[model samples]
Target: MSKIAQELASASTNTEDFYADLKPFANFEQLTNFDRYLPLPDDWFIGVADVVQSTRAIEIGRYKAVNTVAAAVLVAITNALPRLGFPYVFGGDGATVALPGKYLDDVRYELARTAAWAEDSLGLVLRVTIVPVSEIRAAGHDVRVARYAASENVSYAMFTGGGVAWAETQLKKGEFAIHRAPLDAKPNLSGLYCGFGPIPTEQGVILSIIALPLEDQASYRALVADVLTLIEFSSRRSGHPLPEGGPLPSWLGGEIQRLLSRDSPHANLLTAAADALRAIKTRIVLAAGIRIGRFEPSKYRREMWQNTDFRKFDDGLKMTVDCSPEIAEAIEARLIFAERSGVCLAGTHRQKSAHLTCYVPSNIQSDHVHFVDGADGGYAAAAAKKRRVRLPRGTNGHYRANRSIDAGERPHRD
Candidate 1:
């Protein structure tokens, strides 16, 4: 074999044995350079969310609580973005998310809806505004900004309370009289408190929202659902979920805390921030998903693949995915009555979490997979990763057919 071919073969053999060890790239300057290097998707969808009147929370003797809630909201929004097929940024007081160009309308509706809902649910007013990229630059702000990549999260909600609502309603209703006409005198809110500027997205949509009143709650939810439905329909027509990253779980704060404590001297600084951030309602709602692997040594993990039957698929058979041994065992308990073999294997270490693969043999048909966890609902197989496939119960063929045939569909059933 050619040297290149041999090298490729050698690298392929070690793929499963490799996992990226990421440290908190917290240097703002380094992050800025990284942002420039990050090949952003063309025609992104962007939205800015920021808190309204967070100062009031501080004045009301809930300053610490407010900060915690703010961080939580940001985490929640950040977590949900991956699920919705968007890359997001967590500004200290707000967030910016970018969706694919094709998913523009869907993103617009869903983001707006989510922002509104987060406002009500978290008891914090989050204002979301959207604008095009042209507007972003026209306003003299660099829209491409970065927070702590892989480590930090962001959140915001709509405005509440009668006084704030009244003021916001008047603003929307053109109550602010100006020298220029209503359209001509649009307020330029750049770098305001808890305010987000314009955002550019992969989906031709650039959205920027400042403090907007949470007036007409029903209308906002309807708009959100409508946008989501549109996105779903588009996804069905295109047969994909506008591919992006995955949702993160909020509990990841704890994981981050542990990792920092174990590896870094400045763990205290980061941990304090993580603790305060996790207390926020938004982070709780939009946390990232991270699963712990069973406490097997690295050597044992390397050999785990040898025991599994990755190629065999029995008729009516399927695979169950779990985060840890306990989860896998619980799932196994549910499948006690199945007449086929059950194979459980350790998942690769990614980020801070581990995955488990379970081969379920059964007589069921239609080639579908089920996820029992609400947090990880509609889970799908990951890319560039080999997953075990359980074929129909009786056919018993090698599962080599699991090669990806479509953009979104992978070996795992959703």
Candidate 2:
């Protein structure tokens, strides 16, 4: 057999490990480089969980709740495969994770469970879909991925090749609706938190924005860079919009302390006592700046600052920006220019407080990571706006299928 044939055979086998071992890209400076991407194996699958009609949900002021339910899928799946190292990216309204066929059934089961949990506990509708790499390829695309280390503890997944993008469209178009099945497991969400509110900037307001590429536009990345500048937000700040170590706000600590518990405040005596003790201890160490094993607040903050998932590109640019009202106006002006230039479409929301969602390894010191989004209506709102704007048509008939996104479909249900 030819060497290329042999390589293709190997690629079909060690799917996840292949990309996991590829050198991780370092910063936004190299965002446009295509060689960094490694092809996903045909034996793997990509799972997406997005809140249906999230724009409407955000309008009703349930953005924080929406963020949690969307991130809940990641927390659940990681816990299920604690020892495995896979790639996942957090979106304000949902999440995307990829793994090999070996874990397909387990991951799907988790998706079902997460979907049900979102609807039942959170009163939000979640549409989940799992598409095989073969299916992605059959649709004339490949799932390529690269790992980007945002910091010492946070390494995010970056995807390209238009495969995952196609899968998302297929999902929205109802192509994969038959794959959804009944789910019965309860998600393990111990580390998720909405306790902290938005960080106020006398600047004006905090904006959650999502920007998608304009078909045939010169460079979406450059357009996003301009948008960030107008907002006076340095792409340098980490993707986490909130600083949880408590230098900014203190009074909110009491409410946050209560929300940290896993059990109800009205639970029986013993449970309540234990919950209270744990909450207090967590607050003291985190707030008082105590150093425990790997719980150094200062170092973690630095890492978060350097390695946030904001200003990231995975077919589009989605970020949480803290902008003053003046800066917001400037941003609008720039966006209008870009829109007239037929360059990009953006959705933005200004609100108070930021939401934090976490994926805790059974061993917290290992590979735990947290995701953050704007409080009321983060990138979800931004994405909603982007959705309404028509996708630009490529000069060559466009890479996207002809159909518009089926915004009303529930792709996760069988």
lDDT of each: 0.27, 0.61
Clashes of each: 55, 9
lDDT of 2 by residue, 1-414 (tens): 733234457663555576557677666556546566666767889888788777678778776677777777888887788778888888778778889888988988888877776776566778888899878766556666778876656678876656666677766766665233454346666655544445554344666665556564445557766775564454223323544343222333333334334334354656556655665665566566678885775655444445455556565556676656666667767766766776665556677656555544532353556677776766655554323333222221112433344322111111
lDDT of 1 by residue, 1-104 (tens): 73323432444232211111112344322321322222122244344444455444433543222332333333433334423423343322334444444554
- Considering only N, C-alpha and C atoms within 3 Å, which residue pairs clash in candidate 2? 150-307, 197-353, 198-353, 198-354, 203-324, 204-324, 204-325, 239-308, 347-382
After superposition on all CA atoms, what RMSD does each candidate show versus the true structure?
Answer: 26.5, 4.8
The TM-score measured for candidate 2 stands at: 0.80
Candidate 1 segments whose C-alpha is farther than 4 A from its true place: 1-42, 64-87, 138-141, 145-414
Q: In model 1, how large is the Cα lDDT of residue 214?
A: 20
TM-score of every prediction relative to native:
0.29, 0.80
TM-score of 1: 0.29
